[model samples]
Target: MNKVEMHHTIMAAKARKEMTWDHLSELVRKAPVWLASVCYGMNSASPDVAARICEVLELGEDVAIAMTEFPVKSWEKTVPQDPLIYRLYEVVGVYGPTLKDVIQEKFGDGIMSAIDFSMHVEKIEDPKGDRVLLTLNGKFLPYRSW
Candidate 1:
């Protein structure tokens, strides 16, 4: 599958795993909202964030390495860009809702902002086949009313 398709496939699979924002967030002492943002592809992962995410997901180091290869800049010119990068935009725009729904259901009104977040994607070989491991870490900011 192409990047966009691959992105969706990954998301759908993760969603099916029934992973909640709190479950993943609690793994790394990050905010559910921030983690959600990374999952939905609205933000990029920094190195420190990636390491923390790996720690929480128990995904190990290999996959964590690929994940840090993020922050890809696709568009930054006076004109359009390649079709590959374009797919990323589409994937994010469309799947964003799905990610948000899952996060809200798990964390209530809070959100996983990318302001302080990180991610890591790696491939691991299992008996069945190779699996892609993803880890995300963000600051856990509990929402409150003043």
Candidate 2:
């Protein structure tokens, strides 16, 4: 099957098995977000990671192979409509400049490398409500003048 087809199959199987991305990440030995991205066809998995994911999900070797294929990350919308996603877009819209300014002050004319980034999501307990904490770690790449 193709990557998108395999992604659909994976999602269906995950739902059928009542599996969480966190649980799958543990079995696959990859980060939860990264694993979710892989399953969403936004990222590729390594051979070992693909094997583990297939084993855990009881998927075929073909699906595993598809997982190992490189992904073409694309999105149709510039402004997301989903509330959860829109909130993120809003945050970036509001804070992106400040973040860039701060980063440049510290790192000096550099941009954060999404190509070499790692992220984690955590839940913090509070009396009001549980808070979602997202930690993004990326290498800083300073601009080089030739």
Candidate 3:
């Protein structure tokens, strides 16, 4: 975890702080979820979409191109680039428990199942205390939705 990487935290915070649903929507020239959908690579964003998003998000043309032509890997699950996912890591680091609480309240007994999940863990022993270190990451979607 290394405390979830500071640079990672900063970018996610910036995205959450600066990007709004309207802004993201207008950027994609579509619905807000469409931005997520676009980022998720479920669909291709047109040049108009790319231009709008770049302007609103203040993303440079090159990065905008990357998003527009985002590669679609045929894994059963999807993930974004490292920097983007790290941004998500920052969000979770800051709001993890709150999110967990809200999700639990909403879903009731249906926590994010880690089946098909992958995580890395290491054990380190020390005079202070034996440590169990972990980096746990997984794609989250409703289990039944899969």
* Residue ranges of candidate 1 with Cα displaced over 4 Å: 1-80, 124-133
Task: Return whichever of 1 and 3 wins on lDDT.
Answer: 1
Better of 1 and 2 by lDDT: 2
- C-alpha positional error of residue 69 in candidate 1 after TM-score superposition, expressed in Å: 21
Model 2 TM: 0.95
- The ten-residue window of minimal lDDT in model 2 covers 70-79
lDDT scores of the candidates, listed in order: 0.60, 0.92, 0.57
- Best-fitting candidate, measured by lDDT? 2
* Predicted candidate 2 versus true structure: per-residue lDDT over 1-146, tens digit per residue: 78889989999999999999898888788899989999888999889988899899999999999999988888876789899999999999999999999999999998999899999999999999999999999999999999
Instruction: Give per-residue CA lDDT, model 3, range 1-146, as digits (tens).
Output: 11123224323633766766555665456765445545555445677776676566555565455555644444433444589566766777789989788877776535564544445446799999988666655445654543
In the range 1-146, model 1's lDDT, one tens digit per residue, is: 23343335435645766666777777756676666555444444576775776555554454345445554535465333667567656666788899778877877767785557666556799999988666766665657899
Q: In lDDT terms, how accurate is model 2?
A: 0.92
TM-score winner between 1 and 2, please give it: 2
What is the full ranking by lDDT, best candidate first?
Answer: 2, 1, 3
TM-score of each: 0.37, 0.95, 0.37
